[model samples]
Target: MDRSPPVIVFPPESGGGRRVTIRGEAVGTAHGLFDVLELLHSAGLPAVDTAVDDPELIEWRGGGPYDWNDGEADER
Candidate 1:
């Protein structure tokens, strides 16, 4: 049986804040890598420092880590 990853980082919202979910439960919103790390830490997750970049540990949707932009560019 294939099991999903424990942590899920949703697509960036309108404000560049992504939704984080752990074990199928909504945890919080994160605007950057540090924020995601903090959320993982608060969730009592182990090895959060390294887990942030672990694809198997965290499922990044829409974009990978470091992608906090809301997909908008400034008009010249």
Candidate 2:
């Protein structure tokens, strides 16, 4: 059976915030997520947190599906 991939929508960082759109199926794995984060960080837009409805399906924010030891960032 085939399943439709989840959609990842990144909220804006500040003031009227811009929306960043990314495909879930294209980045539905740990590595893919990490790569996305790294890309964002490199672009000077590191995510403060991520949110998703389905935990088992995908981690929408804050390094989902991966162990993050850095607790310095606020996820509120």
Candidate 3:
């Protein structure tokens, strides 16, 4: 199974929030990384940290936590 932050879909009207649809299943609604884990845990799945901290899954670690939004348009 692909463990690279399972591609999720945020459909409209999902209980008034962005329902996290992972692997075609609507686990729950989340808006951040921490919430992602909560959703997974609720589904009986391991948290993202478990995957990121696992040495064997280094390839999917995303190569360190670097600047995610450094370059961006100055919207004033």
Candidate 4:
């Protein structure tokens, strides 16, 4: 069974921002890794800097952490 993580990073929109959700609740939009980490930290996730890269912690839908553009196709 492929269960999704608590945090999900949606694909980047035309504005170059990716939507972030925690436990299915929309949190905010992030334009970069720092923004993502900030959101996660604000959401009360510990070790966010390292957690951002953990597949078990976050699900990067469209692209990896570095992708902040709309060029990538949706990977959901």
lDDT tens readout by residue for model 1, 1-28: 9978899998889866899999999989
Q: Count the backbone clashes (under 3 Å) in each candidate.
A: 0, 2, 0, 0
Q: What is the lDDT of residue 49 in candidate 4?
A: 69
The TM-score of predicted model 4 comes to: 0.82
lDDT per residue for candidate 3 within 1-76, as digits (tens), equals 7455453524323233345655566677543446656766776666676643443422212222221122222132
Write down the lDDT of every candidate, Cα atoms only.
0.80, 0.36, 0.44, 0.82
Winner by lDDT: 4
How large is the C-alpha RMSD of every model relative to the true structure? 4.1, 12.0, 8.2, 4.6
How much is 53 displaced in model 1, in angstroms? 1.7
- Off by more than 4 A, model 1: 72-76
Which of the two, 1 or 3, has more lDDT?
1
**TM-score per candidate, in order?**
0.82, 0.25, 0.40, 0.82
User: Which stretches of model 2 miss by more than 4 angstroms?
Assistant: 1-31, 49-76
lDDT digits (tens) for residues 1-76 of candidate 4 = 9787999998889877899999999999987888878888888886456887899889998788877778554243
What TM-score number comes out for model 3?
Answer: 0.40
Ranking by lDDT: 4, 1, 3, 2
Given candidate 2, what's the lDDT at residue 68?
27
Better of 2 and 4 by TM-score: 4
